[model samples]
Target: MTDEAGSAGALTATAGGGRWPDLREVPFKPRAPWFNGDLQTIRNFLVVEGLGRGPAPPASRRMELPLNDGTGDRLLADYSQGEEGRGLIVLIHGLSGCSASAYMKASAAAFDAAGYSTLRLNLRGAGPSAGLSSDCYHSGRTEDLANALRTLQDQDDRIFQRGLCLVGYSLGGNMLLKFLAEYAGDFPVTAAATVCAPIDLAAASRWFDRRRNRIYQRRLLNWMLRDAVRLPLSSTQRDAIMAARTVYGFDEVFTAPRFGFESADDYYAKSSARRFLSGIETPSLLVEAQDDPWVPTASYDNVDWSVLPRLHRLSAEGGGHVGFHDNASRVPWHDRRILSFFEWVAG
Candidate 1:
């Protein structure tokens, strides 16, 4: 995909001569004034502070939001409160990231600024409750999330009784999209947003296999492997996992079997959001970076946008994986974009 900005406009397959559509082309009017500072500079400062100080948000204020997935899993939900008058924003983090992730906290801060309460759902085995579940969360596991949403809806009915908005990053994005598609009008989500999602897991796996993507591959694989080791499994299963060389091999040996899929192909076929996007009816926005090393631009082509009239696709030029550092100012373009989109929808 070419990186020529502003040349490509529409999200149609043929738009921009097959290159991913530029985010600027999407007809979105920001509810708040455009941030005037240098974003990259801010991103650099934040990165330094992030690495040195190691995420300074309050120790996540969590609650035991139970779920009846029939597996007897105890799902723990966490939230950071906003000012008195704002709405509610529900956030889901990426594969290994929990509610404590910098992006999650930053987004929560943004939502809070707009007077919105934020709920960060920690997938079954992640975060403080890692010891609570024997089975880990996979991309296809949406039942727990569905249950979480229901719980949120019930709680909101008592509190705000207004609207609920969702924003998910990476794997969480895949879950959010799939949930919306599968549960269509069943839930009361007013608007949704997904960032740097691995919409097509097969293509994403291939993308991560490239030489330049080795660092990302190694990082993620190591995390998965570490988590796999933490879980309880049979000796044969443990041996199979220990013998795996690559991420694909590990998934084939561990994730596929544990998740009840015949293989990774079956998991990808069923879980990839591209296949389910056509059925989504909620007003949703999908923001992806063409240069993301983990998620491929090719997946965008697989989407059937015509079936989802309220869906908007924003493919920008320079976000890396979930990194959308626009300039040295350290201000995130995607964060601003998300706030803008939600503000419009909320209005």
Candidate 2:
């Protein structure tokens, strides 16, 4: 809570010749029956994703981006055009999530409604593009994102004038932050946002290992294991991945070795977004629930926000990992809040 950038005063700071909207003032009361952190988190799975919850986005045009790396790995994305004047918003999904994820679709619908075209990207070996890549995506795969951006720019000339905005969920958010920091002046990215990101990968992994988070950990691990086994990995790697019980174990056995890390600890240390946060010069918003079931608040607490002037954060008391269901509005709280941030930056 030190430096608390979401405070009223901090929210009004000048940017792009105008004052930024105070998104913190927009309250997020947990909806009926989903009051506590656990309830909020659980509600996400219980509710159907795109079954008449809101206006479904227009059918998206599928685009495939081949990674610049010699590996011939390709990533797929669904692009839907909106009011062109507003610009483009690229949405990145979390671990085990795809372009078809509930949150991604909801957020895309919200952005499309607000006049920004949206692209829902599937990282390496995720979603519909699971078979397109032999290598899996790690938290530090900024180069892949860079390649995607370059491809997008080449495909659409408007991006050069209107600029680009990015929104990432969970692990995807960590990748966005690292990309912004590491490739600061590379892309024509105007603004960015991260929801429920584990900036400190090591800390988040330890939290996931906790007994209270066992169920969530098991589900995520199973999804990952299933997807990894489908890849063209060796039988030994497949057996090792299946033998892993926890997320940390999976990372230690599979992720670390495949990504060229000496070990899980080394991978987490090198790939964590925390180390790159201070280097971020782009305007960005970070949304986190203190009671997030997986990402520990202690990781957010350890950061010195004073150095990250460009990163606006909202560390809510409760919303439960990516589940910011608001009582007052049918639209998700984060969708509304992030749109406001993008508007401010686009101004």
Candidate 3:
């Protein structure tokens, strides 16, 4: 089918009250050999690069947005001008991930192929932005996002008319939710979506550190330490992050102290998106797997969905963390779901 026809199908797929796909009619069935959560989660690493990715994004140019915080910290993004009228999508990556992340590239390519211009944002010190910012990026660093949007708005007024959509993965998802809530009505955001975001920081940290999840925890912590050392920091700060054994420990020693929180617990409590969901006024989508390894299901359950009328929760019975490899297609399920939701909103 043509792209335009597909977009229309997606736009009409949403049920009343804005729920997409109506699960009873379109449930996610994981592909063979990846039917379970663990297998689904690891499949990305094992699969060949570009196996199912869409066409290469049209020629792109780099854009650096300086944070307004006066620290001289700047964020990097790859902007690709797509066919006009399709609008723009800003994609944020998960913990220790960047614009080059497999998921980010795949999603950007998919959206660009669908005619939407795309920007893959590398959070402070991530990807090409390493050592560009002395200050650290935490879940509540909405100001950086605000600065980026304002700068873009000033440069191109078309964003306001064509509309802007934000899509975040994992930790970035948490940050996006907070930004949507804390900065509601401040920007002309047409829609937003999060994939496997740990909305409750404290809960996710606890679950991640569990013995069953030690493998994933260790790898992520190592990436964090490696990236942290590249930034300009005092020896004391360097030592704290390097010596850390777990994600929580790393946060306690570096992220919390450096960001002015009393402790890791305080940092988690203050930075978690769960506290700000009620304030989100934009049409937002939250996608999570019931059997996610790192983020416990309770973290998602804790939110009182009834209070947030604008939020659409898609708690799939399977798909793992950021791994929604359905039997019907090679592309991850959430990508199609999100693109559809965006079409509906922009329609």
Candidate 4:
């Protein structure tokens, strides 16, 4: 990839100040006024840019990967590859997301076109894999991903031939970081990248409840509410879920109790990826937007980066919650940057 900025080196010293270079040295152009800041974020949900974004590579096949979380749950994944592959990228979707999420599909297509194999994975309860587990999927559920990859590794040699990496969005990004920090050596993961991850779970909850971000909170809660009714809940669990009116209320009533967390506060405290950033062993890139409506900048600001030798932060001042949509390329800015970073790590 060539730099748009008139610079000699790929590593430009950025104000975000880290051992790694700036992620957006070339700058991003949204191609429209409505595609700016928070609007860009909302537009992503409202419109499918596939019109002028170019054709995505054809999907190969979607397979059901068995989860070894001891719950006998099966997760779904869409695997696609190009001829003469470079490596595999396991995609973890955000909350209320699955293999079918627009961002997930867009990123998969971009990666596939770039000679990398992609697996768009749906969490335990997301997509058609919903009924496979009685328990709901949460931001803390990294063990499920671990199990899925292990199962794949045992059966497919291609998974490890070139390299294996992970790219997660939003809440999925938090779990990806957590899994890398907590279980880095357990899997042969070469590298990992996260976009708009709510590293501080509590801060993210607060952000969600804010007036400006309520639309996202409401939409996500609506999805959870719709799913709660279908979950295999006992009489009491069903009652508690019905009583929830907010994000905290839902987590306190259903998420904490079902997952063995003492309370909502405790769940957020333990599950927050901020606490695990320093412990990450594999080389990782965490992409965050300063203007994100649902995730606070402080979450990335207070992190102890010195302890994370293998981790890097791509702190962009304005990429609102995974909305790094740029018109300069057919692929999203995050996808291009992530693929570039992954290729660098693979080499």
Best by lDDT: 2
Candidate 4 lDDT over 92-210, as tens digits, reads: 99988888777887888778777778888888888877867656689988888888888888768657778788998999999998998777688778989999999999999998898
**Per-candidate TM vs. native?**
0.83, 0.92, 0.92, 0.91
Q: What C-alpha root-mean-square deviation, in Å, does candidate 1 show against the real structure?
A: 6.8
lDDT of 1 by residue, 1-347 (tens): 11222233323443223422334643322212222222322232356245643223433467776566676666676676666656677888888777777777766755665567778778888875576776778887888788777766665564444567889899999988998888747766788999888989888888878886576567677777777777777899989988876677887998888888999888888998888887787778798876666788879867766555677878776565666654322335676667666655665
Decide which is better by TM-score, 1 or 3: 3
Candidate 4 segments whose C-alpha is farther than 4 A from its true place: 1-9, 12-21, 49-57
Task: Give each model's whole-structure lDDT.
Answer: 0.69, 0.83, 0.81, 0.79
Which model, 2 or 4, shows the larger lDDT?
A: 2
Point out where model 3 deviates above 4 Å: 1-24, 48-58
Poorest lDDT segment (10 consecutive residues) of candidate 1: 29-38
At residue 290, candidate 1 shows an lDDT of 69
Per-residue error for 229 in candidate 2, Å, reads 0.9
lDDT of 2 by residue, 58-99 (tens): 569999988868888889999988775777889999998999
Clashes (candidate 3): 0
| Number of the top TM-score candidate | 2
Clashes of each: 17, 0, 0, 0
Output the worst ten-in-a-row residue range by lDDT, candidate 4. 1-10
Q: Note the residue pairs that clash in candidate 4.
A: none
Model 2 bad stretches (over 4 Å): 1-20, 50-55
Q: What's the ranking of the predictions by lDDT, best on top?
A: 2, 3, 4, 1
